[model samples]
Target: MFGWLRRKFGKTDRFARLDATQFPRFAPGTVWLVGAGPGAPGLISLLGYYGLGEADTIVYDALVGPDLLAMANPRAEMIYAGKRGGKPSPKQADITLTLIEHARAGKKVLRLKGGDPMMFGRGGEEALALARESIGFRIVPGITAGVGGLAYAGIPVTHRDTNHAVIFLTGHDEKGGVPQAVDWPAVSTAAPVIVMYMAIKHLGSIAEKLVAAGRSPEDRLAVVSNATLPSQSVVETTLADASTLAARTDIPTPAIVVVGPVSRYRQTLDWYTGGENALG
Candidate 1:
């Protein structure tokens, strides 16, 4: 009846707006908070795929891979919201405001973040800001570094003998420094395995804190640089030697530090057995 009504009203199609009603409409006033997953593009969730297709504007970060962006509609607007520590980058508030502005302008906004938006990705802040403005939003979760990166390295976070539990911590805090809020003593004592993100520069302080917390000086540690990338590198060290090991190595930023018994598994589990040709 509605189709006939529309056609009788001189519309070319039976239901001109059927597409919007049938498909998950990227409503003009809503923002889709999407996770791009860890470096691998195939790891993105189905909702992420849909959001990319439906979005009119996509605001992405540095960690997001280009493959995921390629899935966005050709006509979709793309914006870079990368925030590198110690580098000139866009403010968090500004990024949040951009989403609001795009949605207010009747654009379907996609706020794409790297890894799981809730896991150290700061998606909560953006969601809160959207809520304050009465903007409708959706969250699409993605695989986080704690699991995805470790898988690429062929290291299982939980092994029957090695570890029953794993703890993930950010090396950088709100100010992008080694987070002082973490109780190193408690973490070192309780967690069987520790994955530290953005803590390369502060390895010295972190190692010292771990040692002070009664962790063995020779406790195994592995720093996996550029995890899951072609240029990835892994260096095996110990709690006491972590600072020196990292300082001597040419590993770059965006590395993951695995500490505890699990770190020892990388010695044999590291399938990327190629020699250090680039570092040479």
Candidate 2:
């Protein structure tokens, strides 16, 4: 409703009203593991925005978009430690060491990641390493795509009529293959809604396993690609067609997969169309 106020005042004028003293100072010689949120630059938390303005170094990932990085302090060093399909991602140990090196040098370090830093982003591992080295750090949470992205697609992750519970899992393990540890049988029945991150590569196998383990082949599934971005798109399919869909479609990376009746909401609840708010 205040879109006009935002348009009139703009974010710059609005930002002037923030009470900086209320926030913990981003001191030099410390690191902050900040989640960049799903995809939208504006989704970054206020604390995250504070860190971006104060940090001396931004250790960002592939999912950290250029627009988001533009918010950082002009003098902040930008370090790319992202995993590309064909190129080698810097070693975890190396990334940890880098954070430590910069922190020890008395720099305010921002280990910026896509989505919640703690959720599958390996922020815990880096935190552990930092702890061992006595490096002070903080965790700044952001919205994960599984929830925010699904909402953008008009799919509520939960609904009283459909599911009392939901499940979240990765499609691949440390070795970048289908996780061998998931007990498909148990997973198939554990929740009415299943959300998979980084699962597109092995989605065919995952869909097959779920179907074989008692989940219906006809269950609704939504493949949300580049979720929350202007280019975001959702492919409504079923477990039976998941494999074929995975093989035939060139869905973008950084996608989230949803299974169960929650996807049925997309037909009516979809409020984002061609990057515009459908409710408008």
Candidate 3:
């Protein structure tokens, strides 16, 4: 079954050549929730790659890279179910229903999401929906942008000399506003490093909250845009100036915001922009 895939995509540098049978089969009438990783197609897992090759229908998000999508069987049907903040996107209910409908039709449905499906990608909700409907499903984890994207930007989420703990949180709640449940003061003080996903839209407000919570105005912060992709860009700034600096830059969304001293390590670890340094 993997002979064709090995013949076609096995020579890629990022993925080691291996038998496709090692991965889970994309059974008929079942949905596979896969993470495409940040934006780099090569970051997709071996299982995810196999699912792409076998899926009969692919329901993908806005952040899934084109190269990854191109790996799907040409005869497969592609459906766009992207959800962007403040933009017109398919309703979550509708997307879940689409997955169920396609699976019920005896098609091998692949719900390809950007980043780790379970990590802020709404994979839980979708999985729950499939469970309620008694649909068989499998999860193929992908590198989430929060960590992988930051790595691509040369920012380590953790460094022994800098931090021992990290916190990951989304910037907005369901209503497209700053999350109200988070204890801003505790987050500001306790977490040595904070990695925020989908926080660019409300960055200014979030920054303000952090500042009011006792985080220093000059705390190092880095905003990595289009992370892990060739078009990626990193903006280094401080907590107080993050909103102003980001506003003046052309960095695009689907970005990750990292806070802490670990961001400073980018100066020596920026492999994409800077040559290899002694740090790594």
User: How many pairs of residues collide in each model?
Assistant: 0, 0, 0
Superposed model 3: Cα runs more than 4 Å off: 6-17, 275-280
**Model 2 lDDT-worst window of ten:** 1-10
Global lDDT of each model?
A: 0.81, 0.88, 0.88
Q: Which one wins by lDDT: 1 or 3? A: 3
Candidate 1, 211-260: lDDT as tens digits: 99988998888877777777676778789998797576487767888888
TM-score, candidate number 1: 0.86
Backbone clash tally for model 1?
A: 0
lDDT of 2 by residue, 8-111 (tens): 44654665566434788788999999999999999999889888888899999998899888878878899999975436789888898999999999999999
lDDT per residue for candidate 3 within 108-137, as digits (tens), equals: 999999999999999999999999999999
Note the residue pairs that clash in candidate 3. none
* TM-score preference between candidates 1 and 2, better one: 2
Clashing pairs in 2: none
Measured by TM-score, how close is model 2 to the native structure? Answer: 0.93
Assess every candidate by TM-score: 0.86, 0.93, 0.93
Alpha-carbon runs more than 4 Å astray in model 1: 1-25, 271-280
